[model samples]
Target: MSAPLRLILFDVDGTLVDSQATIFAAMRAAFSAAGLETPTRPALLSGVGLSLPVLMKMLVPEADERTQDQLVTGYKEAYHDLRLTQGAAHSPLYPGARGLLEQLSETPDVLLGVATGKSKRGLDQLIEAHGLERMFVTRQVADHHPSKPHPSMIDTARSEIGASQGDTVMIGDTSFDMQMAEAAGVAGIGVTWGYHPRDALGSAQHMVEDFAQLAGVLNKFWTVDHE
Candidate 1:
């Protein structure tokens, strides 16, 4: 008999690509364009996994909805322009990222998916740039979901992949990803190389320091018999 299906969901920014430089630059440009004070690096980095609108609100809590919308629009434009100028190489994958994905893709009964705060266009650009268009089976982006820490993205991915919560795992760099996994009743695995600090990822069932250690951590989950 075939092995039970295993759904592995990934988060994009801090989890996959180290887009810190690109993100920070674009955020500064956005605030400058909007005639507002640029947020500190720490403040900006802290909000990495949230949707644009929600992120703007966190950065400038006193701003009205209209101002927040304007900031979000400005940020998107700046980020897109920067991406065009720098190309995909500007955002490098963390060490062992591609190899880990390749290994997971080759595993039997394993399916890969992405649940990211990035927009669909952004996600597609990153995937295509890295020649990973065929890797992920399902792509869930912030364009459709409410935001991170919400279970909607994970729930949708699980449903589309037809994998029970017990057979799925969420791997990411932030507490938002861990919380989302918990809400979906799936295993949450945190990576230390991402944006959020290790202490913030307390919700994760397992935490690995690097991508090389991820396979072993995940193997424990995949080998379990949920039936």
Candidate 2:
């Protein structure tokens, strides 16, 4: 018999929400203030599905830990401050984020949680304002566990959903997500709607071009282990 899916861990920024413009704007501001090269929009995107510290270390590598700290502090403060009012304003949910969440919620056997690179505070605030808190059983953010490409966060979310490694799936838009799922020995699906382009999701087992395709894909993928 195939393993059954009991949990689905999703990435926050790129997968469920469209915060690219806000992220890019805040990143540019922080980089400029730190006297680092302001990343282009595309370059900024490379950070979306990854960890904050990882992104900071890559973009502002010339900085020492203290400088990196300042940049992070600045970035978070700016993003949080500006984003509170703009919550999903500058960034909207991808086409079917709400519908997908609702559909998944209706499944008594399926549990949902967010495994994202966002800070816990950031996730809480954003989810609350965006009306997404009810859809997830748990919210695992960047610093809450080791960042992506690491399975700790995924593992943690699975635990929250009462799912074992054999019965959970990871959904994201980047190689980091795919790598994490692969490392955890679970299935991973990469979505094209997120920051990483389709080509960037090299390690994913499945890929979808839009939100509408998600439900059908998931319904099928969810049962792959059951057969």
Candidate 3:
């Protein structure tokens, strides 16, 4: 008989790739182009798992809808321009991310997916740049679903992969990811080497200090049957 199918969904920004520099730069550029003051680094990083529009609004709630829209467009353009000029080399994956992903991908019962706030275009670019095109079976992005903490992305990924909630896990570095996993009725594993602090990931079912720990944790998570 075939092994039980397991779905592992990942969050892009703070989870897999450390894109803080690029994200902050784009946020600064967007705020500048909109003639608004830039938020501090911590403030910017705090919204890492949220969609661009939602993040912009959170950063500048006093701004009107038109201004929010302008900020969104500006952020996208700035981010795209940065990607073109600097390439994906600027957004490096955390230590052991590639190796762990490769190991998981080779596991017959494991199916990897991405549930991220990144747009499909951005996700595609990053995946291609990192030669990770074959890593994920399903790619859920902000353009197609509600932002993190809503469970829509995880829900969609599970559906596409035909994995039950108990057989699925969401790995990320933010409370948004943990909340989304809970909302989807799946397990959440939080990584501490990302943008959010360990305390922020209280909603996570398990927390790992680094990718090495994450790998071991995932091994157990997959091997053990979960209710």
Question: Could you tell me every candidate's TM-score relative to the true structure?
Answer: 0.97, 0.93, 0.97
* Candidate 3 lDDT, 14-85, residue by residue in tens: 889999999989988999998999999999999999998899889899999999999999999999998888
Query: Backbone clash tally for model 3?
Result: 0
Give me candidate 3's TM-score against the actual structure.
0.97
The 10-residue segment of model 1 with minimum total lDDT is 218-227
Residue 102 alpha-carbon offset, candidate 1, angstroms: 0.8
* Model 3 residue 55 lDDT score: 92
Model 2 Cα lDDT, one tens digit per residue, 1-227: 64344888898788888888888888877877888778788777887766777888877677799878878877888798778767658567888889989989888778888888888888888887878878888788887777788898887777666687767888998888989999988889999888888897888988998888878888887556456
Clashes of each: 0, 3, 0
Q: After best superposition, candidate 2 residue 46: deviation in angstroms?
A: 1.1
Model 3 alpha-carbon miss at residue 45, Å: 0.7
Give the per-residue lDDT digits (tens) of candidate 1, residues 1-227.
Answer: 87768899999999989999999989988888889999999899899999999999999999899888888998899889888888876688888999999999998889999999999999999898899988999999999999989999999998898998888999999999999999989999999998999999999999999887898888866665342
Ranked candidates, highest TM-score first: 3, 1, 2
Report each candidate's C-alpha RMSD, comma-separated, in the order given: 1.2, 2.2, 1.1
Query: Global lDDT for candidate 1?
Result: 0.91
